[model samples]
Target: MFKLFLLTSLLFLLPIFHCYSLPEPCSGTCVNAHDPSIVIRPNGTYFRFSTGGKIAIHTAPDLRGPWTYKGAALPNGSKINLKGNQDLWAPDVSLVDNLYHLFYSVSTFGSQASAIGLARSPSMDAGTWTDLGAAGISSDATKRYNAIDPNLIYVNGTYHMSFGSFWDGIFQVEMNSPPTTAKSNVQPTQIVHNSAESAMEGPALFRYGEYYYLFFSKGQCCGLDRSRPAAGKEYRIMVCRSGVSTGGFVDKSGRACTNGGGTVVLESHGWVYGPGGQGVFQDPVHGPVVYYHYVDTRVGYADGQKRFGWNKLDFTTGWPAV
Candidate 1:
């Protein structure tokens, strides 16, 4: 009877013990990236494209990479006639139709004058990208949405894009075949927003089980030295899920994402600070993984010095946990 009692008590205590355990810190070299979008090539190479001069490229044999710099994806700069076209941000890459399509943001910092550009390459190697002009555009004066931070996901033979930052949060638009531009005459739907600060962006949609999970970064990103938002609130990852692809997203509390609802997925802990601008990819070996950039506060806040971060996501609870 004592053995039976102890066994029952242990089972009751197991979940409590697990809940107190800290999450696994991201390992390996994480250097020089912001708004990183990663893809594993067919040849087993990992490529990470990030924000910088014409979209920076980093390659490695594995996810825990001794990453090597391979120049910019578009060394010639964007075809868009924006003021800061060379200084790109938030690149998302995916394999489509035997070509690797890379969508990147072209914009000046702190301005809504932005355009999302497309570049395609037969290989993931640098200097091979053929610039395919502007996929979408946004301006401060007329458009309600900003077109930076583009993320593309294909669902049931259709392509959909989620892009925007700051002004009114995340927006989704359908893309026609060839996947370069948005479908003509269709308006983008506002899928996620933060009522408090209007500070949600970096929409990464992942289809897991019966739900479509929309993950986005909320609060202030970048400028860690000069400014920081509320402690533990700045640049954290939040999520909502929907049964269908286009709309009806809600948080863990059953609140609609359209009304500033989201469940916190990852926030600052230990050395990792302001971990935002995230993307999700399914690894052949590690299952589902979330990738992003975080400020290393120990190293002091330096421009372009943010480090890469990734962790295998746990979905046993029917929702993604880092």
Candidate 2:
């Protein structure tokens, strides 16, 4: 019965081998992807939504893509009736109840007169979205938070959103429904901020094991040609973790996230420069993966093109390592 025992052992080990295999990184000409949010379809097709050019859409059959451009998600522009609302930035997508919900930022660069607009599609495809107008706005002169870089996550049966850029780091509000809108009664809580610099944005939240992790990009972004920061100081990814979903986030050294405290998650290495605008997704095969855009210094920053970057996350030591 040795052959029978050998066959049984092989079958048991097959699934374990498949689960631990690392995913192939995105390859080929990956360009013009900024502030990207990636989602996988039921059939395992990859759909990546990004900032600028009216929220551009790109698709690939696998992670290591022969990625194809699929045109703009919002061709006619936002229905918010703002002057510079056409150029959408930082679109976050999630599928709920058979509907694909897209939340994007509408504003002029460096202006606080901004709103986060909502759009939906039955299928997460380009040119199929219907804009649902303003989900939230930050038009008041006294308000410090800018309504941009929207990231939505479901925590403990409640829908919560963490959004804001530059002025006040990241803020969180409980959503009344999935994908769009927030509860009117609960005010937005300032969850993470950096006091050392006025540069903080692109807040992405992911829950791993018993703690919730907050990932955000800090330092100057864009205009690399005119004024690039010190070699290693340009846009970089930082992270903090909290036991509760809403507040009390701190870095590995026990420094509060609201007080300029963040542990560097990923930064520039060699040709990769200014890596930021990050989002985390759980791959069915490869566990947790971090997706973001980084400028290729080899191509020169003046070219104004950003490429997609992703790495599998390891939490074996109790904190995420790429």
Candidate 3:
């Protein structure tokens, strides 16, 4: 009948209309979450590690709900004694050998006087993490790389940390077993570099099927006051993929990522502004999920006012969809 046809037509059109509206996050306080990284406990508790306030810890029973702000992971701060030791950034956490190992960044903004440090906890409970000093990688002002935004990835029976910011783009280095430190005598290799040679950081590497998806942020990341960057120059989630862990990453367009080519995974749309600093995890309920910090234009754009956002990734098309 005409009535039945009208109902079906509206149903198909709804997704096109609502696709830009991101799902709301957390039932309680999800504010102050910048550079968000998610780790789920075996018992289904979600722990959020983010940059700021000594790597602040927030937890929830489920990803959607009644989140509670737990205390700092390191109340006393990092043991590395760097300039930004008290205010950690870009925490990448993973559970290995029954212990939760966290790799965090210690650096001041715009300076390569930065170091990545390691810490671990038997349980991801707040105040339980013990700093294990630097993870054996650093960069000074004279270096080509800024050495921040650390993401821990395991591939082919070895561990590698992908990190970089501003100056050069993204790089990866091998780590020995236990992965407490970077392997000595091994030089870091450049994995993904934008051709423009600027403003790419926060690499979260993951293996989905045959390719290693290199998800990173591109363009201006902070200070979106008054005016924003011109269109694609604002902070957006970009991705490249490689068959192997080390290099040869290309975008969906078959363009080399190192040649300033990357597929935009998510960008400013509707109320969601400058969504980057992303991390991914395979969730039991949601499957593959990408979590990030986004400036909700409705809320304001200060770093502290940033919000945690997540979406289940659809890889049906051989590339991730938010």
| Clashing pairs for predicted structure model 3, backbone only | 195-260
Which ranges in model 1 have alpha carbons more than 4 Å from their true place? Answer: 1-29
lDDT of 2 by residue, 1-322 (tens): 9999999989988853212212246765477788999999999998988887788888888766878888899999899987667888899999877998899988877888888889999987887999999886454446778888888888668888889987877898888766468787888989888777878999998889998999999987888878989855789889999988888999999999999889988787767888889999888877898888888777767524888888889999778888
By lDDT rank, best first, the candidates go 3, 1, 2
The per-model lDDT (C-alpha) reads: 0.84, 0.83, 0.87
Local accuracy of candidate 1 as per-residue lDDT tens digits, 1-322 = 9999999989987753212113335344467788888888888999989888678888888888878888899988888898888787788999999999999888877788888889999998998999998985455657777888888888889999988887878899999897888997899999987678788889999999999999999988877788788775689889999998888999999999988899988877777778889998788987898888887778866657788888889899988987
Mark the 10 consecutive residues where model 2 has the least summed lDDT: 15-24
Model 3 lDDT tens row, 197-282: 48899999989899899999998788786567887688989899999988899999999877887898888888888999999888
Report the CA-based lDDT of candidate 3 relative to the real structure. 0.87
Provide the global lDDT of candidate 1 against the true structure.
0.84
For model 1 the local lDDT of residue 78 reads: 87
Question: Whose TM-score is greatest here?
Answer: 3
**Which scores better on lDDT, 2 or 3?**
3
